[model samples]
Target: MILYIKYMVSLRCKILVKDELIKLGLHYVIVDLGTVEILENITQQQHDELKKSLLKSGLELLDDKKSILIEKIKAVIIEMVHYAEELPVTNYSNYISDKLGYDYTYLSNTFSEVKGVNIQQFIILHKIEKVKELLLYDDLNLTEIAYKLHYSSVSHLSNQFKKITGLSPSYFKKIKMKRSGNLENT
Candidate 1:
């Protein structure tokens, strides 16, 4: 049985889901960013109990097809932004459409209708958060960060970063404040 979980974003979230499955005596084959594959099908009682437990921790087991699709979109975007070492030179719309096997326009429209933000805006938000992470690590220069995140140039990266964050990348790094992504989505 496969279960889609909404709001499971981090490695810690994966751990929490795994622990919950174990506590419920459910054997899971795999637990990825936003979904879990169980070795055996679950009973209604077990499913209800799991749902309640997950809700307490701010996670919800997605049952609707549309919600599941939205979660898949979120998972792919999150993975690309946070975990991938590099992004393609092509535009993100083409990349995402090819990856998800759907028309870019359809996906973007659905995402915006469901999430109240355009896909590009979401990508920018995630990319900005990635920039914040790299800056905090102090292992890469602005140029390198721009390249890794697929920005055209350091200036472009800085421009977008400032537009989104209201602070230049250098200024942000100097301030050393704990920066983060969109809380509702991330």
Candidate 2:
């Protein structure tokens, strides 16, 4: 049985889910982002227990088909943006369609309806967040960050960064440095 989880986007969330499954004595075959496959049929008691336990941690057990599908899309996007070592060379639409085995139009429409943002916009937002994280690390230059995230060029990254954050990358970096007491870096 495949169980879908809402907000299972991070390593910590995955660990929390595994711990919950273990506590429930539920044998799980696989636990990936937003999903868990179990080896046995779940009784209502077990399901409710798991659901209640997960809820205590701010996670949710998804039930309806649309919610599951939407969570799946979110999981894929989160993995792609925040976790993947390299972004796919293919366009976002095709990458998402192939990942979810649904037509891009359906996925796009569903995501827009549920999230109030198109998938591409969602990707941009996530990418910008990742950019901010990388900047905080002070490990990579803007060019390298742009290349790692597969931006067409530094200008493209800067444009999207400004659009999403209302601050240019350099200005954002300066703010972070000043806040961290590294004014010399700024």
Candidate 3:
């Protein structure tokens, strides 16, 4: 059985889900991002138990198709922005559309409807979060960060970062204070 889960966006989340499955004596073939493939069919009892366990850890199993699709879209975006070592050469819309096998308009509309924000808004939000992470690390300059995040130019990145975060990239890096919406919230 394949189970789609919400808020399973990080390596630590994957590990936690794997541990929970093992503790429940369930065998899973794979656990990735938002979905898990299990070796054995699950019983209602196991499902309920797993749900309760996952809930305690702030994760939920998705039963509805629409909700699952939304999570899949979010997962794909999150993976591309955060986990991938480098950005793709193609435009994000094309890359995401090809990856998810859905039209860009449909995916964007669905994502916006479910997430209460447009896809571009979500991408900007996430990119800003990435900039915060990079800035805090103090390992990259504005230009490098801009290039790493695939911004057209440092000025463009700074403008967007300031618009979303209310602080310029340079000021943000210098302050090193807690900005809202980091990895924990996202």
TM-score per candidate, in order?
0.87, 0.92, 0.88
Candidate 3 has its poorest 10 consecutive residues by lDDT at 175-184
Global lDDT of each candidate: 0.88, 0.91, 0.87
What are the clashing pairs of model 3? none
User: Ten residues in a row with the worst lDDT in model 1?
Assistant: 177-186
lDDT of 1 by residue, 9-114 (tens): 7778888888889999999998987889999999999999999999988889989887887888888898888888678677888888988899999899899999
What would you estimate as the lDDT of candidate 3? 0.87
Q: Judged by TM-score, which candidate is best?
A: 2
Better of 2 and 3 by TM-score: 2
Off by over 4 Å in 2: 182-186
State, as a TM-score between 0 and 1, how close model 2 is to the true structure.
0.92
lDDT tens readout by residue for model 3, 1-186: 899888657778998899899999999998988899999999999999989999999999888888998888888888888889997789989998999899999999898888899878888888899889988865888899999989999999989998998988878876665454354467
Report how far residue 47 has shifted in candidate 2, in Å.
1.2
